[model samples]
Target: MNDKTQDIAIVGGGLAGASLALLLSHHLPQLKITLIESFPLFNSDNEKSLPSYDDRSSALSLGSCRILQTLTIWSQLKPYLTAIEKVHVSDRGHPAGTLLDYRELDDISDEEALGYVVENRHLGQVLLSALAQQSNIDTISPATVAEVTPQADEAQLVIRQGDKQQRLAANLIVIADGAHSSLREKLGIAVEKSDYGQVAVIANITSSGYHDGVAYERFTDSGPMALLPLGDFNDEHRSALVWTVDSDREADVVAMSDEAFLQTIQQRFGNRLGFFTRVGKRHIYPLALYKAKEQIRRHIVLMGNAAHAMHPVAGQGFNLALRDCSALVDTLCDATVRGQSPGELDVLNHYLSRQDLDQEKTIGTSHLLTLLFSTAETLPAFARNTGLFGLNFLPGIKAWFARQAMGVAGNRSQIAQPASSTAAEKRIK
Candidate 1:
């Protein structure tokens, strides 16, 4: 294609793109990786959209923890992470609730947490830092991909950086630029989208007492509200809150005063952690289910939000993307070690095929959770409450839910291996 052709060129330096580069570089040291981001890597002196570096919070399932461990950045991330030892799920005003405890999972120790919650900005910083230290990985920032042309052997990209425009070529191109990826459109990939008619409002909150590392998922008439434990703040326990509300009410919710908002949250979430005394800057995003019709096309592959974006009900969006990252790494590294072309249609297709089942299960689960918890309909509400009771009533169901919350259930890939169990054991020691 060109004198400077790359082995793999990734578009978007967010979580998926950055992690993919690091994972592949670590496993296949012989291959060269180039990562391109349309926005600034982080908040700079100059104002720019730093999507990867934001105040948002993400829950990392234990399965996702293993993938990070495989990439070798988990150790650096552990200090700042707050463990999710248990997930307390309930419907507002309903006595019936489900507790997906880590102890429910077989071989899972009581000390081991089901997941960890970290600010997206912190995790992104860790991944970006790790990427920077990789000798085989090249990072590009504040650049835009004006176009992508896929040829028989390689894909070409027209990138615009500042005032200069250049043509770059690669054996394969990965698109991970989030839900509204322009490169995906340039490649003529269609997305199947369903709007949930809701918006997610996120903020940091503090309670009167300790959270004990328990995450709360409370379903109200408005929607599902999640308060993930985040250690503490100024002698008060802190948590990250994600509340889904009807699109029509989003504006009013966002406009509320902090004290009034806290009162409303207390009313909806009950006195679980005592009172939500303080609230921080709030952010909101419209909720929807968006899936790429085709995950891979010839010399290109889609990843992260570009591949599939679902509701944040289960906090599986980034977790699923990390799993997709692991599957791609496994497939490509195996093929490369065996002397196969990573850009081959068969190679890309294999990655897509393996991810399909996981994506299906995750997307379906999130959609069903959103529907069941958000609806005020009597029948669906009754069934949801019944399902919550089933989690505790049936051992098999409790174990299954625990596995899902731990992020170890669906697929068995090299990345999703029980390596984290070893880490958990070490933690216990």
Candidate 2:
């Protein structure tokens, strides 16, 4: 077996792993990084070959957009994005509803939308393309990590590619294999999980009326549903639909005829965007919240879905992960200046310390929203509707809620700052 040494090794090449690799390469060009994946990487032509780059869409919060913008590839992703100008939230049977407009935000200008939505495939393409252009990053795909052994100084990885094997040593190892992480299990890391007893049915839909860049979040007795605006395809006014339902209804919902599915969703979602005209392919996945017991070890770090997976009722999952990435980058950059090893426990702990509060707040809010909106209990129902109604009258509270949704409510990371203000940008040139 051949042996190699690198400054860092990433276990997964999915969205989180790819984004981390790019951030590291951009900010710390002197460090040698290796990215490992079980699936083939850079096969953009065959979208099905890559599981992460599916037909689903991701809502990029304003803060997440700023993070991507700092990477200098947002322009490449711009054409594929659909801006969300307003957010209309309401309860199915209640007369109370609130409209969150982008113009109402104090920090955001009229030229900027509250957030943007882009197809996952397009996002994957841009990230991969940027990774290909980095000179300091090495990608090893169509392979897997069979074992990881941490030593006194660094972590060793046993890699497998078909019949051949290789040994790799790195100062730091980032695990981003997904929510169901096999690598995390091998390391004896435990996770706390809460099953919501629900599943989300996702599909792209067309409506008779244009969406006008308005995203809708409507809560029903059954569950919460969201319709996020999408860029038109083939001249059809389109939106992405995420409808949560009881787990027992999964098979029936996926098996429904297109017309039946459209009618059912129309009845639940109302006529905000006119009648539901077309329903595309449907996909279903069970809903659960999972958080790793430990995010950091002596020479390891768990990232993205591997560390925390929350309910999507509030659309905060990916945005939170991106913020974690930004914080990690900042911490590592500081370590390099101090002439410290990235694998030091103190360094890893500092990274976690910076993110612990954000993670706790984001995860707690998502769980609360899922529970508060997924039931018809008299007390909870009245409280939620009253809160929604009050948002219309309370500008301070409503703005705070909007900032939370935009992923900019709390302290912003320095790495997510604009190119001119970020100290890391100086290293790039």
- Among these predicted structures, which one has the highest TM-score? 2
Candidate 2 per-residue lDDT over residues 1-429, each given as its tens digit: 988889999998887898999989988899999999998887746644566678778899877888888787888999999999899999999999999887666446544678899998889889888988899999888899989889999999999999999999999999988999998999999999999999999999999889999999999877999999998888989999999999988888978999999999999999989988899889887899999999999999999999999887888878898999999999999999999988899999999999999899999999999999999899889989999999999988887777777777666678776445432222112
User: Which pairs clash (backbone N, Cα, C closer than 3 Å) in model 1?
Assistant: none
Model 1 scores worst on lDDT over the 10 consecutive residues at 420-429
Candidate 2 wrongly placed segments (more than 4 Å): 45-47, 418-429
Q: Judge candidate 2 at residue 197 and give its lDDT.
A: 96
Model 2 poorest ten-residue lDDT run: 420-429
For residues 254-317, write the lDDT of model 1, one tens digit per residue: 8899999999999998897998789999999999999999889878999999999999999999
TM-score versus the correct structure, for each prediction: 0.95, 0.96
Q: List the residue pairs that clash in candidate 2.
A: none
